[model samples]
Target: MSIKLGIIGGGVMGEAILSRLIAQQVYRPDQVLVSDPQAQRREVLSQRYGVNVTSDNGVAAKADEVLLLAIKPQVFKAVASDLVSKDGNHSSASETLPMVISILAGVSLTELEAAFEHQPVIRAMPNTPATVGAGITAIAPGKTVTANHIEQAKTLLGAVGEVVEVSESLMDAVTGLSGSGPAYVAVMIEALADGGVAAGLPRAIASKLALSTVWGTAQLLQDKQIHPAQLKDQVTSPGGTTIAGIAELERSGFRSALIEAVQAAYRRSQQLGK
Candidate 1:
């Protein structure tokens, strides 16, 4: 059966994109197909989203339009092997080849193209916050991809959050920064909440305060289009509490620590790609 969108995984990230796409009416439930090995996952997706589900990966891989790969990177090769026939072909000769978009981290275009044969491939890096629809994703296209292929990918990924186009060379850096950024931001919020507790706030109140403060600060920076240093200066009046906190953070090398964290993560992404 022909479908508009084929999804090769029904995991958290896949479900997030699928739910958003359906809720936004980008694709009707009838036009989508999801493939997962677990019967429970297939059942959950079918019942919750009212979309077709299958245990066979090849069925979804041959979709009439776009195919999304949301599975873990470690299993990509093994799962991709399941899509190929004995003749080493996945797509029907008469059908329009599907555009393949992979959200699997560290799986290079070289590997994907080799597996998919002539299909246009786009590699993407998206963070965990995508589950909540507040994430950002960066996509890099393969040699065979055209502008239309990219716009189609943006539409699919945009269902979850913002989409950015970047060269494959910078994908590892994207992974280190925005791709793993949610964890860093979460840690900062958690630490801030702990600090509030140390200063006499209740745990629940501190948590809420920390979360709101970070979120509001981000919104303010984005809306106002101001530099972070400018925001810092505005809050750091002479001998004020904000300045005192800033001094402590600076003394503890907070900024450098974050920078180093991204660099370290970038290095790790490179290692994984190799």
Candidate 2:
């Protein structure tokens, strides 16, 4: 099947996705259309990715087989309103309606369906790490979606990262855990660097080592298929230095703090959706 993709909003997330898809050669440049009101952003994306460009959301939505809504949550209603108006302009009800995949934070499938009049909609949460092609995305499909639509959404999203199918109810939790997870990890890396600096390493080397440690550890944990707890055990000798540090972390309520942070994010996401 010919896949024509239309993307609304060419901000950081939109540009990141387009760059990855272009680099991977998964879809021809001509098959993709990007719409952003900012002329500078449109010009940069057009020059960088060599895709069709437009300032009209309706034009982009109507030109493609699949439409991706990458705008901010605040602007979603406006965009949806425009799409509905375009649909109304068509004389026939049987006119083809593009399947929509939304990456707007806190936007729900129900609201999207309501705005688009019960069209097949998929809501996805993707993280900043997608810029580096190392992101994880979670998707929840609406009731009207078909198997083919689901697969197509997966294929498009998977171009920039690993895509996981999830229940709509868990989407906020997924956002908390993974969508905001990168910043948490980044903060930990910064702290680890500070620790190394206090331990007599130069600031530059400390930062590099701290980041490498996290990267290498994550690679080992994933590649070895070992439980993270088991990996931690492997590094901690009985009653040794690592165990002492672990004790301090537990005493300081590190795990509890992380859990609470995730819960807080989840709650905020839910509130925004409402």
- For this target, which candidate reaches the highest TM-score against the unseen true structure? 1
Please report how far candidate 1 places residue 17 from its true position, in Å: 0.5
Q: Write the per-residue lDDT of candidate 1 for residues 143-214, one digit (tens) a residue.
A: 999999999999989988899999999999999999888889999999999999999999999999999999
Model 1 Cα shift for residue 59 (angstroms): 0.3
Worst 10-residue stretch by lDDT in candidate 2? 86-95
TM-score of 1: 0.96
Q: Write the per-residue lDDT of candidate 2 for residues 1-274, one digit (tens) a residue.
A: 2438889999988888888888888678888989999999888988988898989887787644688888999989888788677763223447787788899988888788787653578999999999888888999999888999989888777888899999999999999999999989999999999999999999999999999999999999989999999999999999899999999999999999999999999998889888
Q: Please, what is the TM-score per model?
A: 0.96, 0.95
Please name the candidate that would achieve the greatest lDDT relative to the true structure. 1
Off by over 4 Å in 1: 86-95
